[model samples]
Target: MARCEFCGVEADFPFICSYCRRPYCVGHRLPEAHECPNIIFARPPDHVRKIFEGRLEEPARHVRPVLTSELKQLLLAWLVLGFCFSVNSLTAPQLFITTLLISLGTLGLGFIGHELAHRYVAR
Candidate 1:
């Protein structure tokens, strides 16, 4: 089990950066405003600029600079698309099997993409 670096808590499901290989707990994870991989991949483009601007406007806390630009854009794009599909499914015609497949596929893709993102990003 990996212990959280910031909180010193034991974690079986530690969220680690695939690029940097740094382990962190959910609590210790980067804020949505920072430019971490989670921010780059998980955040919508609309919010990233606001995050960037906030950091500049506030001098109370230090913000880490983006260290690397290497990323799996395709995987991130696919995962984002899957999320959209799941959301849009609310209005989709209720085809039982189709809905089930879409839901399952979305979950599977999300899990796989998360791991792959870590693998590609972590050194």
Candidate 2:
């Protein structure tokens, strides 16, 4: 409910200027835009400024590895499922191997596809 000090317009959502501690609308929120008196406060404190400056000296490490921690559990689960299917399918010698393989392959695909769909939807 605060009004923009610079524009004198009532701000529905105010952005409080860190430097001057004055509420402003998005347009006049920046210290430069509002002609903030205490522009020196715009710079971060020495310790924090030093930490950020130090980081800039080193080349950024941007290699983000994809997580595969659940892979072992997923593979183990597929093995158990395949074994169960194979055991039950032992009665038919000719069609047993083909049926088990095809079913397990499709089941794994379906499971992976379903999980990916859920992830995308949530994201």
On lDDT, the leading prediction is 2
Pairs of residues at least 3 apart in sequence or in different chains that clash in candidate 1: 18-118, 18-121, 18-122, 19-121, 19-122
Tens digits of per-residue lDDT for model 2, 1-123: 899999999999999988788999999999989999998778676642335655644545786456565656666677667667677678887677886787679776676677668768997
The CA lDDT of each predicted structure is 0.61, 0.78
Candidate closest to the true structure, highest TM-score:
2
Candidate 1, superposed: residue stretches over 4 Å from native: 31-123
User: Could you tell me the lDDT of residue 40 within candidate 2?
Assistant: 75
lDDT of 2 at 35: 94
lDDT for model 2, please.
Answer: 0.78
**Residue lDDT tens for model 1, 1-123:** 998765778889987755445677877666342235544565455633335745654335675555534335545666566555566556665654476467558775776778678877985
Shift of residue 96 alpha carbon in model 2, Å: 2.2
What are the runs in model 2 whose C-alpha is more than 4 Å off? 1-67, 118-123
RMSD of 2: 7.8
Candidate 2 lDDT trough over 10 residues, lowest sum: 47-56
Q: What is the Å distance of residue 60 in model 1 from its true position?
A: 35
